[model samples]
Target: MLGLIGIVMSSEDPNNTDQKTRLEMLNDSVIKLDSFIEDILNYSRNTRMGVVMEEINFEEILEEIRNGHKFMEGANKLKPLVEIIQKEKFISDKKRIIVILNNIISNAIKYRDTSKEESFVSVFVECDSKKAVITIEDNGIGIADDKQEKVFDMFYRATKLSNGSGLGMYIVKETLEKLDGIITLESSLNKGTKFSIQIPNQTN
Candidate 1:
């Protein structure tokens, strides 16, 4: 529908300012819709595929995620602090880990409290022989205590502030479950949110 509108509007007289403005708006909507569809596809693909674990570097993955967000609209205003407390390689699905990190980071940026003096997202990783523990903290608009539990539910939008499909966290939880991992959340309204995740050091 949006595409058809855009095509029709494109044929309007070039001098018709009103038509041109509407066409531009429709084009932007189409771009956003395309992105939303791609995210849903990625979520579905991750859930259907079996986990493929291999030795992977924790820091390298974090750097890639950070670099990917450099061009995002408000990325510069939000500080992304990444720290690997214990440098260790783990056997895990690298792609899924990327998906998990990307979703969390994306949320941190999307839901940031612009009223604050500054906003930041911090990632900490601690790994031992048995498992790797990751803590992702974001100084964003925190989830209300009442809505915290539903954040992982499919299609649940915790806040009206979101323009996304609300499947990011759901995909995160599903992907983690497939790897026998656990995730927990903590937040205080108006302050921030923290996610503690644990994945096995070795998976069968």
Candidate 2:
């Protein structure tokens, strides 16, 4: 990748279309490799480390996640609507929860249904002291009925739109298992996808 970058940099016509395309491709490859490495590290962390309990600030973290992806293409189209109803303080593994939400949200953005004029991702959370119920819904290119069951399976790519090694949802499943959480999904071919995840709140 470095050699390719050097070549692109040293090109006689710096603005050449072919060189620009090659550089773009190289940049994409780097991003993909970085995502894969992060996934691996996440897998190790979720599998090996014990859950560290902490108070969860839902609104703050959700906003943080939204800000992190504002630079993504089409992010502007998918406005995130967040609704939080919390009667009591929610306690859980903060990092793990962030990981789960980030993966799902990123996928929603990447596989968004471009045919629609209005697209949105809504996150609704209702929690008491016992557990947290999170629903993330997106108007995007959804998984087919047949493929939905196997989405959490290792390296399963339900659609060609998937670019990763398909470990995103696998790691999500693993992390949820570690947290004693339950995840369910609903989707249509081109309409959208909704994910409902519930995890027990740890009392510290």
Candidate 3:
């Protein structure tokens, strides 16, 4: 009876361990998913919420984003490779523009190749007669050629190791489409990724 009891306890120990591991993983996944959902809410609120559109300063919006986000700060903590090549002021809704810039910049910071010696990211802004273009590029682990299209899909991750809810790009795509804009991606694995966004200057 004593031996049987000991064996039962031993058997249960492994089960408990497995259960604990699964629970922790689930919790982490939930947290990541929650953050992703919050980002979507922010994007939605920027457009759908009861805020009237007004003439906004893009430089101020970018500055406010730079000042508030801790993630970008950390990205530049080690030798500071992230760079804003150009900044521009545009006449648009402040909240909406902020949401668009924040999402793109946040991902650039988050996906940076921390292992590299010169981890860097860049943002460029240009406005012309017809439209405005914003480009965000990063020297991070880029997407594979085949999986590039999948990045825009909801809840799609290229690898099992990705610790994310996989909704960032999806939200980005949806937001741009809603705003009558288009986003283009150029990427190569181990090289990097560049996202070029073009939006019309006229108000909707």
Best by TM-score: 2
TM-score of 1: 0.85
Which of the two, 1 or 3, has more TM-score?
1
Pairs that clash in candidate 2 = none
Output candidate 2 Cα RMSD.
Answer: 3.1
Q: Write the per-residue lDDT of candidate 1 for residues 16-133, one digit (tens) a residue.
A: 9987887878776775686589678878888578878798688888889888877555889998888886655578889999988888988898889999999999999988777899
Pairs of residues clashing in candidate 1 = none
Whole-model lDDT, candidate 2?
A: 0.88
Name the lDDT value of residue 183 in candidate 2: 97
Give residue 103's error in model 1 in angstroms: 0.2
Clashes of each: 0, 0, 0
lDDT (C-alpha, whole model) for all candidates? 0.86, 0.88, 0.67
Error of 2 at 2 (Å): 12
lDDT of 2 by residue, 1-204 (tens): 645665666764865878677777887787688788989999889988999988999888898899988766678888788999988888889999989999999898889998998889999999987899999999898889999999999889889977887899999999998889999999998989999999998874
lDDT ranking, best first? 2, 1, 3
The RMSD of every model to the true structure, in order and in angstroms, is 4.3, 3.1, 9.4
Tens-digit lDDT string for candidate 3 (13-65): 56587755755565556557667677768756745765445655556667787
Clashing pairs in 3: none
